[model samples]
Target chain A: MSDLSVLYDAPGPKAKRNATIGSVVVGLALLAVLYVVYARLDEKGQWSWDLWGPLLDPSNEVFELVWQNLGTGLRNTLTGALVAITLSLLLGVVFGVARVMLGRWARIPVVGLIEILRGLPVIVMMFMAYQLLPALGVNYEPLPGPDAFWYMVVGLTLYNLAVFAEILRSGVNSLPKGQREAGLVIGLTPLQTMVMIQLPQAFRTMLPAIISQMVVVLKDTSLIMFLGQYPELLYQAKIIYQDLGNTLQTLVVVGIIFIAINFALSQLAVWVEKRMSRRSAGKSIDPIMATTAAPVKV
Target chain B: MNVIIDNFDLFFQGFLKTLGIGLICMVGSLILGTIIAAFRVSPVAPLRAVGTLYVNLIRNCPLTVVLFLIAFGLPTIGINQSYYFFGCSALIIYTASFVCEALRSGINAIPAGQAEAARAIGLGFTQNLRHVILPQAFRTAIPPTGSVIIAMFKNSAVLGVFGVSGDLLGNAIILTGSRGFDPVPVYLGIGFFFLMITIPAGLVLGYLERKAVILR
Candidate 1:
């Protein structure tokens, strides 16, 4: 008999019959659950066009306004995410390299900083930036974006930078010792070896991981809603639903947008991972460890 | 310092709530995640598809969106519960996706021969998984599952802002917003409490990771 999985052999005639029956039963159960959900929503008049028309109808004036607001909110969310991703990477590389290259005495404080940053929740950092910073006279006027934008960016950057740094550090550590020794043997200083040889390779190997972190940053920009006055997508969706009396529709739409964008980014990560593993073949590093090593504390 | 001392009761209560939520979600997600992991690895194609769909849809959407959907959307359909219940459900649902992936990976790491041997001995698929595979998989799965739970603890902080009061972040918000406490010490207190849990948990997880390494 042909083997399909270690867990099971290819089904014999009796087994195949049993499998088909199981499939039919499960399929019907799933369909029944969906029907129940649909019936409930229909009972509540949730299918009424008045609730969905503002989001779905192109000709409606409210539809135009809704789209425009959501568009602006999407733009702001992307702006914040883009800036945060950029800064997190730059800072991650700097601190990652420093942690590796610095003397033990110097590294201790850096370790402390990274641990604290990694430990705190992103929402806490966001609150500190949005509420605490202004109270302490840390003005945002010098920055180009709105105060809330900068706050969101800073909060995301602080948490993500620590995570990115840990990823890079682990990437560097996972490399063969020969690579580092050979650089030192060739008369390169440790810092030069790390900068010229090690860090670039770490970046290449860690690219998939870095991209995944970008998804986390993109998703986190939604938290700007709590900061007030920041018209990020979730916040704008709130405004839309509140104004239009379509809470369920607006959130579902926003959720779909988030799922679409983040799913694309996650797919990009998986694609990079496949390519990287192919290129390195036998020496492939585990990209999953790079992510799970330092938990993404969103 | 004065702000923290004055609001010690608030901080203490918040800490308990945060710990409570973390504990509840950890147990909930583990049980749910184990079931999903089984669905994923089952020989049934439809079951596998459902598992994959659930994991992907939940994992890609931000936890915040999940929270918003459950916290706001459920009430409209007459499934209204305490905000705390909604928050805990969202966290459990979101975190379970990651846990399922971790467990599936652990199962995949097992040698094919083991499962083949179980079936060669005339074991059914369920017995093969239960008696032969899963017991081994849990060991390999411990580290990643620990990381997921730790991340869940941090994520529980989000519930504080989503109308689930009495968590660490919620207390900080109250002190800063309505109580008019200085924002600096108030937030620092919150940060301190989070680190109190996360730092120690990280140490424990690290030790467990080393211990869990299969010698083979």
Candidate 2:
């Protein structure tokens, strides 16, 4: 009853009757649609144990093949995401700081770079790196994994760099002007203040967003499968389905894996966010007392 | 440039298909999202649960996985359709979660008193939502909704991943492979069309948001 105000009041006797009828109608309509979709799927033999049994059986040979391929694909996908995250986070921080702190001439170029990189589709950037770069004599033969890995990493880095820069810049910009002024008042240089005072707090403020971006990085790794043949989870799933002739079963397994990993990741981020907010709230006790020079009579 | 000129018809077809898919998905997701948002804010328990479960499931899953499921899995279910149709369906399904979340936030921004007042005036659930709540809520929702649409449009590039060759990305790939053209310009050409659609849409949406009437 207390939460009822959040949306609407509790229905009166007359209104309750109407609501019940309305909800029943809505429920029936939804159920009818679901039944139709389910019937169609069932007709296609999608529910057959023959198509799905091998995937479920622990002792089956097909499971062994799938498990091995899953390892390789998972490793490659992680490698791409890890390398891209490391490069992008570092470069993003640098670019973000420069955009805010650098002179007008320097800031303009950074702005232009961020804009162009952000505007282009990630796949197009990947294509450029994989297909266009080798043509331009920019070979990465020494790089680990296939050419596509480097291309995907570089592509992800370019796109994410722009995104992370914006995130960090806004995080920093949102801080109080007094924080910077206090640094200057204490005889610290602007650079010192930014590094020692501003950045630490900005990192804390930006951690949740950065973690969410990591989820994006993981998802973008799947896009690399489209550019060229790479041993990512999606590509492996494609191969398995074609070989086993159980397209639906293979894809369902792969989709479950992706959802599990990503869902866990996002949940962890939410947990950390809650914990951090609690810690920050505890630390910021007595804001007025901390800010005042002298105590006033109660 | 020569490749584009020679394959103008192919590019034009690709443009039309991309536009068609984009428009269809946008409308579909918006309508579905509004319904889901209503469910989330509804007083009934089952309706709220359904909305919550859907948004949680769809938002966490990758678009590629969803598309793959639709493209490959639908055939097994005897619902075989063109890749384009399945691709459009996937985009609609995935994008609707984001749109629902956006609209839910908009709904949440309205003061509790607004809803209470409407109920006091004897307005029913649907009437309150349509006449009082949504018009005000949409003013705050415009920015996030625009972003969801833009992201959805960018994501439609992946329709080619399903071998739907009637999109900008698929056409670019085919043009490069068949015509031996440089990929840079081909991609640039494709990117131009996307930016043309999205950037203008963003600017107009921003203007609309600024001009939107705030009821509360």
| Highest DockQ scorer | 1
The C-alpha local distance difference test score for the whole of candidate 2 amounts to 0.75
Sliding window of 10 residues with minimal summed lDDT for model 1 chain A: A280-289
Residues forming the 10-long window of minimal summed lDDT in candidate 2 chain A? A289-298
Off by over 4 Å in 1: A1-4, A135-137, A140-145, A281-289, A294-298
Docking outcome class, model 2: acceptable
Superposed Cα deviation of residue B172, candidate 2 (Å): 1.9
Query: Residue A29 in model 1: shift from native, Å?
Result: 1.3
| Candidates 1 onward: DockQ, in order | 0.60, 0.36
* Residue B31, candidate 1: alpha-carbon lDDT: 97
- Which window of ten consecutive residues has the lowest lDDT sum in model 2 chain B? B197-206
What is the C-alpha lDDT profile of model 1 across A1-298, one tens digit per residue?
Answer: 0132778877999989998898899999999988887888888888899999999999877899999999999998899899999999899989888888889899998889999998888888888777667777787653334677888888999999999998888778767788889999999999899888788777777888788778878988987777656789998898898899888889889888888998988888878888987653124544443477444321
Shift in Å, residue A257, candidate 2: 1.7
lDDT of 2 by residue, A167-285 (tens): 67766776788888999999999889888887777666666667777877888888887777778888887788788777878777877777778778777666666666654312211
